[model samples]
Target: MKLSPSVTIEQSETGLEFIKVASEFCDATIFLQGAQITEFTPTGKKPLLWVSQQEDYQEGKGVRGGIPICWPWFGVSQHEGWPAHGVARTGLWRAEQVKEEENSIYISLSLPMNQIDEKYWPHKTKLLVEFILSTSLEVRLTTTNLDSETLNFTQALHTYFPTPAIEETKVDGLQGSKYIEFGEGPFEQHDLVSFARETDMVYTQAQDTQRIITPDGIIEVSRENSRSCVLWNPWIDKSKRLSNFADDEYHVMLCLEAANVLEDSVELAPGDKHTLATSLRWV
Candidate 1:
């Protein structure tokens, strides 16, 4: 992997390799495992991304924060004993390109299709993730079908963000959309989303833009080629059972994932391609 002047190769505490990116606009840390980005902070602002302090950073393990890529499938898998959220998160990805631009730095990586287990992902396809780091952060996940038959899959850029206090953070722009929670009714959102209990809501026909209003300020989140979004906060009971997570951590962090899920899952025909993208900035 060729490195640009703004990007350097670094290794985790557990010896896993990653890319350390520094530019005039922002700084970031991207791991080769899962090609996951664990950090992104603009020139002189608080971080726009968050991670668990207890994350092990172990080999072939998923980190507990930032933008973890969920591909091929989302949530529980239909196949018995198959890993939930598919295999892309822990699979090692190869750095394909890096270029420093005047405004934003571009970094690209690809997962080797042969590395995937046939039982889990048998279809012929190509997977790539590209990152644009600047004052704002952008991540794009692309899937290209090479099989003769059509294929369908669900995915999400599972982004974790920080808040001074969960009670003080609310999300706007999802109002009027239909959603379901814990297999419950397809309720419609009538107001800006606020956290009061264990929240796990999957929204379809969601607006492309949403604003996370925190005590500090508002962070604008937008998606491309996505109308499905998952808003999750483990609140109290489930937090104790989570790994690489502190029990009380729920008070400071939440996930507003940009996803292709439920009725919005992707369907690609032979020789077709699709891209799911998410971008964020303080507004």
Candidate 2:
């Protein structure tokens, strides 16, 4: 573990390595495993990210909350018996750089192809997740195709936002997008989204910005170089089936992920690169 004035490389009680940031504007924590950010609290405001209180933080298992990097793939595997949400979330990433600016602190972590299992994704690629922590949290996930041929994949910055009560929270700016739930209808969204039941919807033709109205305040979620967003809330029954998640805990968290899934999946030629990014702030 390494310690600095603004950043620290530390290990969790469960022996997982993470980078901790305490800047002039906010405090954040990013786990080297999966290159995931589990906490982001801007000064004088509620936390911008949410993590499960029951999260085990164990190796080879993803933490229940914050921003889980769903890379190479998102959701269930097309292949039989493969891990859902790909292997990047549980694989240990290498921290490459940390820099402090006047107002924000930046950290970069990378996952190399050598660390991945060829059976699941055989492409030789490089994955990097960069964090810019300040009054707002900004994340950028970049993928570089290092192989000779073209590479394609789906991905998401699966971000969980905290709400005083899930039932009372509403998301704005998806009013005109088209969505599909549980692989069902490409329903059109005409109103602000609110959770009623086990909500899982993939939205397309979405705007670049959305707002989450929570009891605490309005959280502004903005995206770049992305066209798909996912809204999910496991209301009652499905919550019981999730690992490291409490059945009743679903009442306090909701996910509005910025993603490139389904029709928005990326295809990169040799030596090509793509970047997917999202930013969050309390407005």
Candidate 3:
């Protein structure tokens, strides 16, 4: 396998690991953690995409609130260190396969051991995450629980979109329903509000997909297994402290997550499998 000097890649029993990211958008990295896309830079007319920064936690990173992956609980489950977001996300995975396809590269990462899974989840579960980059980006995640006990989990492909300005952006696909709005203030009001400021809103009973329109282009999001959708943009001064983000990064991006969590959780019985996928085709 050819390794890019821009990233630090390590081998894991379950999958490949990306320990460091030090490149411009053109030379980005991917990690075993949820098969997360760390940085994306499109050449020529191509668009630069950064996987949802939500997965990596910092006091204030970017407008990309969280990479949308929920299990047991959305943020922190009752289990705590397992972290409501689940340990699999941050856990090191093994790179099982990599192929250079037509327009992009196809990379696959799988979980290391089913034995370690028994600590938090009662069943034996194996996870496979694939990253397909071509004209746009595609991510496919599959979970197979081998043990007799059923597996319950929640997740989302939290995506942070970059734009010239937030004022010039509008997200489609969640037009008809009302959402649970978390206000501009920290854990502020739960009342429903339009897209503005630091907002945490979950759109329920949604269409299978949606789109974010920017003056420069459009980001189309479609999914198979995600039921709930979260739209977030932590505006105001929250953009300053992040390491990689610019001071006014919030002015340039919006967060649209592909998620299935809480009431929308998925159940997998022994020998049963479930698949969830999302594609970001830029136009």
Candidate 4:
């Protein structure tokens, strides 16, 4: 793999390995441990992604920001004692391909079943995350079922975005969707969403696009093959209990994930494949 002059492999202080990008248009970093992209900033603009300043870049742990690949399942495990957001977030993935274009860099990483514990996900599956970095960041997570039977799963490109202040940020384009939060009703979103307290909402039958209004600018989040989305912010108290995150960090970060959860979970037949993708850009 011949990387672009702007891309290089580097290790964190804790010996965690990642690919760093420093191109003329943007700068980014992605760790191989989880294939997680931790930072993205376009030239002459505010950062598009938010990473925890208190994050400990240690082995076998998910970094506090960027896009975390939630696979097999999105939230709490059906079985006890299993890791939340599934094993793909912490499983080491192998970089299989890298191609640099005139204006963008492309990287593909693969995670086979052998690299994960069968206890968490007992199926023959091949997961690949393709990252396209340019003026904007785009991610495509493809899952192939190698087993003979049907396989079911839920997933998300859990992306965290930065804001000047949480209270001042608003998310648009969810007006007609249905959502559930904190085991509450499937309420109808009649207007643009704004935050005051902690908010965790799972939206179904959502539109394919959304706009995040931040002080710096408006970020357009678009998705494909995804009918469900998650919006989350662990404000104040919950932020205090989170690992690798500062308590006040919640005030500057918000998550509007591109997801397939609830009634929209994916079911694949033998030898079937599915791709869930999302693209982000500041306008």
Best candidate, lDDT: 1
Extract clashing residue pairs from model 2. Answer: none
Cα lDDT tens digits, model 4, 151-184, are 9999999999999888999999999999999989
**Each candidate structure's count of clashing pairs:** 0, 0, 12, 0
| Cα lDDT listed for each candidate | 0.93, 0.91, 0.62, 0.91
What RMSD does each model have against the real structure? 1.0, 1.0, 6.2, 1.2
lDDT of 3 at 244: 54
Per-residue C-alpha lDDT of model 1 across residues 220-244, encoded as one tens digit per residue: 9999998799999999999999999
What is the C-alpha local distance difference test score of candidate 4? 0.91
The better-scoring model by TM-score among 3 and 4 is: 4
Candidate 2 differs from the real structure by a C-alpha RMSD in angstroms, to one decimal, of: 1.0
lDDT of 2: 0.91
> Would you list the rank order by TM-score, best first?
1, 2, 4, 3
Candidate 1: residue 107 lDDT (0-100): 94
> Candidate 1: which stretches are off by over 4 Å?
none
The TM-score obtained by model 3 is 0.75
Worst 10 residues of 4 by lDDT: 1-10
Lowest lDDT 10-residue stretch of candidate 2: 1-10
TM for candidate 2 is 0.98
TM-score of each prediction: 0.98, 0.98, 0.75, 0.97
